[model samples]
Target: MKTDVLIAGAGPVGLTMASELSRYGLSVRLVDKNTQRTDKSKAIVLWARTLELINRMSPNCADRFIETGLKTESVNILSGSEHIGHADMKEVDSKYKFVVMIPQSDTERLLEEHLATFNIKAERQTELTDFKETSDGVTYVLKHADGSEETAEASWLIGADGAHSIVRHKLNKEFHGSTLLSDWMLADIYLTGVQGTPAINIYWHADGILALFPLQGTRHRIIANVGESSGPIGEGNRPAPTVEDIQRVLDTRGPGGIKAEDSVWRSNFSINERKVDDYRSGRVFVAGDAAHVHSPAGGQGMNTGMQDAFNLTWKLALVSRGICQPEPLLSSYSAERSPVAKVLLEFTGRATEAALLRGGVKQSIRNHVASLVLGFAPVTHTMANLLSEISIGYSDSPLNAHTQHPRHGVKPGKRALIRENEPPVGFGDAPRFALFAESNNLPSALLLKYSALLEATPRAPLSPDSLSLVRPDGYVALATKSGDWNAVDAYLNQFLPKAS
Candidate 1:
């Protein structure tokens, strides 16, 4: 069998890749070795930027997530019983201002259901055992649960297969990074006496950091550092924490009066901060845990991976359909997303280290500094934007183009503000850029020449002096003087087929 794209692993990242490709009318086959979806609540918070991107997938697609998941409006930082500072999600610059607290299991299920709407279901119990990539495409072998092997060909291969990805291994890419020696425990259970509204509460205690993330109703997720590890870092190396163990930590570290009961899940794990330098190798690419995995500190691990799929698929769709050139368009995937992972790794690593501050003098100074810094409105606002991922941009991307005109308003490579009641930039079966300028300012000849690369009608411009060409993924591709049609044409020409 043959397809346009062969996606390995049916987790959230792979599901997202398949969904976006299929939405663009591409043939996609998603395969996973697991027989069933996960029941564990794994990576739990879907930030505002992720929800905004999901909205572009289809009408009311994000609404399904908002309805099913719990909405958290703020993150509070505390030093034992005293409140240090807080970052309010209401201040985030997006329509979906609040972070949605949904389980990874539910996220995968919803993504799979969305993929089904495209008439594509994940091939479960089927694993990618081997693959060889030629100059034009990839030919691979899949091993079935019953021991039958099937050979298939695809125009491209995606490894969303996760940390132990066979695809990444086959490409001979080194995942270089170190693992922290400290151990941490995670618990999902019914709890009482968690104070205040449904917010993320982080208590910086002398022992370690204790964070309580509220789920639907009375359920909550608790994570705490439990000192340095004595054994190797892997599952079953440390025993799962009991309810009593959780309660003890909560009593000692939390802001008092929190009772733990009716435990649902409990596990202990070590944090690994590892990533590959490049996300793509020839016709194959790795995403999610396959490419990078960082500290769960800010719950960015899953959202970053999902956004990787979002960024890569639209470019893939355009190239595979012969609408765009393959060079810079495909190469931009790694160039753009690799920096994001690099930044994320550094940010999460710093956060983890800050939380694990041991010495009393260092802890006191860290707490004092954090309290003072977060007390500023601008600091808290920036914190909120970073946590929700609203501030992520590819300013240095090879795809970015700008005119010599003085920069004003949203610059090239920044995300255009997603306004209410307005359809997103990439909302249809075809991946096309949206032009944001007065209809009269648009040259009819320009639209006619690059119809496959641009939207038919121009929306309202950011400013009367400036026009913007936004990518299918909502990033600013070209920002220049309002009447600069020549700049727009030149920008579009770079991606158009050579014959065109």
Candidate 2:
């Protein structure tokens, strides 16, 4: 079997990359070792920026994903049944504030549905055993569940596989980070007799931190920082989570001493933060968990991964089609994403530490401070935006770099912030440059010169350019003041065709 691109591990990020490549009219095939979607809701929040990006890809896709999941408005902090503070994300620019309580399996299922529209479905029950990459492309010896072996080749391969990524290992890449000293457990349960459970709850008990996230329609998904959240359950350790062990937590944590139905699903995972030294090894590249991993406390894990897919696909598409030089563009993948991984890891680590403090005056002081700060509008909105995963921006890629031509052709660097447009749509295979003019058309002067690669849109008004160019993966490619075309050719030449 062969493909122009083969993505391994069809988690949200992998599936997204596959679908994105399809949108560019590229041949893409997605592969996963999992036999089917697992019924667990791991990552539940999509930030404002991500929603904006999705709107460009397919407006209703983001809305449908929202409609499919449980949505919450407030982030409540508690101390052993005592209310500390309630942070409402509704204030954030995005319409959603609390993490949407959707199961991970549902995310995969819905993403799969979106990909099917592009004629790409994740190939299941297949494993890549012997895969090699060279300067030109990648080749793999895959094993089928039926005990047959086949050879596959691709112009490029994306390893969206999770932490223990074979693609990362095959590249002889190193993962540098520490496994957390503690583990945790998350479970989804339906409330039977209990009435009116809160939308979202966090209990900072003397024992540990426990969070109850309300599923859009289901009762709740409980995430507990039970001193490593998972281990042998005994000696007041919740007894290691058998059906009986899990039932005990549900019963004990019940509202008003109320007992709830058993968990519909359960998962135990450890905490760790790590990054791949290199994202690209010749024609094979790593994205999402393949590139970085971190504790899920901030819910940034899934967001970070999906953004990686978003960043890489457009670059690959441009280079493969002879639009830009592959080496420089590929190198930007690590340069742009490494810093983001670092920031997310640090913030999530801080949130986790603050949530799981041992009892003491110092701990009390810290908890008091956390609650106080959380009560502030700015603090909660900041954390909420980070969790939504839309606040991030990328540095100098060919498509997004500050050009010598004119106006605001270059943006605010990786931290640049732009307001979202009401009706968002891309200029056909463009994730890099969005053109905005009052006339709602390309700069007539440069249109013929860069017409083959650039698309100018006149939607609403995005500032001067009033339009934004999104990379194929959906980050702003470049922003320009209205009618600035001095460096247009220079910029386009970096990633697309230019006048001979």
Candidate 3:
């Protein structure tokens, strides 16, 4: 069967991509080699930015996620008995200001249920064995469980298939970077001595870093750096850590008095920071671990991948519908997202390195400096916003356009925060730019001419006599004064043909 988009790997990223395309009234078939969704709570914690983006897709979407997840407002860091630093999510400048602690399992389940609203289900045990990208479309070879192969054609192909992506391999793209030297351990268990508030508690010990992430009532996820590795830990090669193994780390690094029991999931892992140079090649693209993987320092791995889906799917939808030209719209995907990935990699790498520091002098200095710096409210607020990903934007994107007389508040490539009861820019079945200007000052001819590419009516302006054109993904594309209708026309005209 032919489809508009064929998604490989029904993980969170692929599911998100398919859900978005389907939401935009596009045909999508999601396929996975695995027969069923993961039962383990692998990647946990959806930050504020993710929830905000999901809410833009549908009013009830983010609400559903909030219902199933536990909310934590602050992350406290301690060194030995001394309080080092803390990140207070309450300081984040967003409506959903806290981190939502939900397992990757529940995330996928809820996403699948959401996809069911579109009458779509992921085909199980079906894998993309091979494919070729032609000028017209992508031809994919699907291998079934019983070894039967069927060929299908699709207008586009997305590989969310994971780190060992066949699509990336077929494209001959290099996954550059290195594996971190330290071995890590992750445990999901029920704890007894978690006191006071259920905040994320992290202890930076001289030995290693031990982090406790609250999942549910009395249930927490424990992750720690366990020193140098003999070699890379392979899947299922290393046995699960026993209760005593976790207790030892807790007794040595924890803030004292926490007892562990009722172990749910435990495994040993090594951190690897690898990413491809580009996200798109011809009609094929990759997201999630397939495109980038990094140290789980700030829990940004899955969130970043999912945002990649959010970023690309909107542009792809617009281009596929012939509303926007392919050159800048499609090309901007890599230009915009690749830099974000690079920044994330550097941040996570430094975090992991600091956490794994073995030298006593360096560790002491780090702890002392951290305490002094993070004690400031502004520093903590910045950390909170960065961790929540509310501060990320395509500041250098090719799509960003600015006028000489730019407005003061909203700049190009920055997020345009929408208020309550108002529809967000790019919210609906089709992707369209929202023009924010005074109703009288809005150029009626421009709106009439580019009705297919713009909002039906101008929304209330942020500043009087100022005009802002926001993209589908909520980033400001053009910011200029009200009289600069010519600039706005030029910005929109790039996405259309010269003859038009």
Candidate 4:
């Protein structure tokens, strides 16, 4: 294979997958038909959990893109005349809370900048013309804008292209879901709000789902799902939104309002909820909108796509390095991400439904009751964190089933900090299957029974008592307490080669 991985589309998800795979010392090639990434931002936020995972994947990650230009303090949802509830991202105790509002363009630019350090660049204006997949890998015909065609082979091909993805079509993955027949409008503009006040995402029911996301300092974004009776924008995607639309929504929002002004960019969109029948297809897999495209109510599209890369990157790297059997590690990728995507789809869809309610007393009662109850419920306080992102854990993984042996400072199922004395929230995303054999600290324990798993699989970078086994794509394969050889050997031999 000329390249270990070929990523189709240089959007956030594809770019991230490339960066992550490159981290494993793999040769990654990325292609995009877009001549250039635009300055206009589309998706406008990064959740805390995603940011944390990105930082873990690339330590210098957070500092690179996280500017004062990007930070939303919190989220407030208005229900009719009353303030229903708010999501305090600060409560998550993350340096970045809720979602950091940066335009999609800037995000792509930042990711591209990072990829540059790795000596990788997006082959722009290059389209995948023909693709052939064999049991071993995939080969694709790349047609340059100038009409020259070149063939490239890679052990794996990832499709991160958007909804109209050609890769998913070729794979014949079923996207079994419904699209909202009603139309919606989206706009990005400068609002009069100060830098730190809580950004409001109001649900007035009858008015349709209206969301206002903070970006950088004073700029903001608005997305409104239009009522069916309102009629569709004759040119879907080309609504030509005017100050009239902005003024109308603001006027509808009852008094004590902060005005949004000086609209910069505008467009209309139709919301849809959909997911692929499966994310993997032989040596070709799908991520981001290609795999699962849902309504962007929770702002989870980009976050989910990037997280998919995080899950797949380490696994692909480890398998390529002969650290573990390719199947086991790769299988875990879909297992982990699919569930997360399902939950996100459900949450965002429900939020959208509630936001786009038609005028009625029943709607009023439902909105008022929810707002009242949620205001006092502690569970409501966690809504922002849940919506922002989730910290995926492998403790529930069937492959990671094992009993724990207690250590003084060490704990089971936690990503143990390698050298730090401090207690860890979570750590360790190394691309190798790590087994922590603290028993006797002997070479025999590591080399004999656990040899195949230990040969290329390094010891847990975090500690001695912990056995941190990583999958090829860099997620914790199995992190169990170090103990006897019998069970550990059986567990590993199931997936790795036996000692010579």
- lDDT by residue for model 3 (85-169), tens: 9999999888888999999999999999988989999999999999999987999999999999999999999999998999999
Candidate 1 lDDT: 0.91
List lDDT for all candidates, in order. 0.91, 0.68, 0.88, 0.70
Find the candidate with the highest TM-score and give its number: 1
lDDT of 4 by residue, 442-500 (tens): 45654665543453434534454565554433344444555544545555666663466
Positional deviation of residue 179's Cα in model 1 after best superposition, in angstroms? 0.7
lDDT of 2 by residue, 174-219 (tens): 8988776676766766655434534566667666677777775545
Q: Which should have the higher TM-score, number 1 or number 3?
A: 1
Point out the higher-scoring one by TM-score: 2 or 4.
2
**What lDDT score is found at residue 253 in candidate 4?**
52
Segments in model 4 whose C-alpha atoms lie over 4 Å from true places = 93-98, 193-200, 229-238, 254-257, 394-398, 402-430, 433-444, 447-490, 497-500
Q: Estimate each model's TM-score.
A: 0.98, 0.87, 0.97, 0.86
**TM-score of candidate 1 on Cα atoms, chains taken together:** 0.98
Model 3 off-target regions past 4 Å? Answer: 232-237, 497-500
Residue-pair clashes per prediction, in order, are: 0, 22, 0, 15
- List model 1 lDDT by residue over 29-53, tens digit each: 9999999878899999999999999
Question: Residue 101, candidate 2: how far off, in angstroms?
Answer: 1.7
Flag clash pairs in model 3.
Answer: none
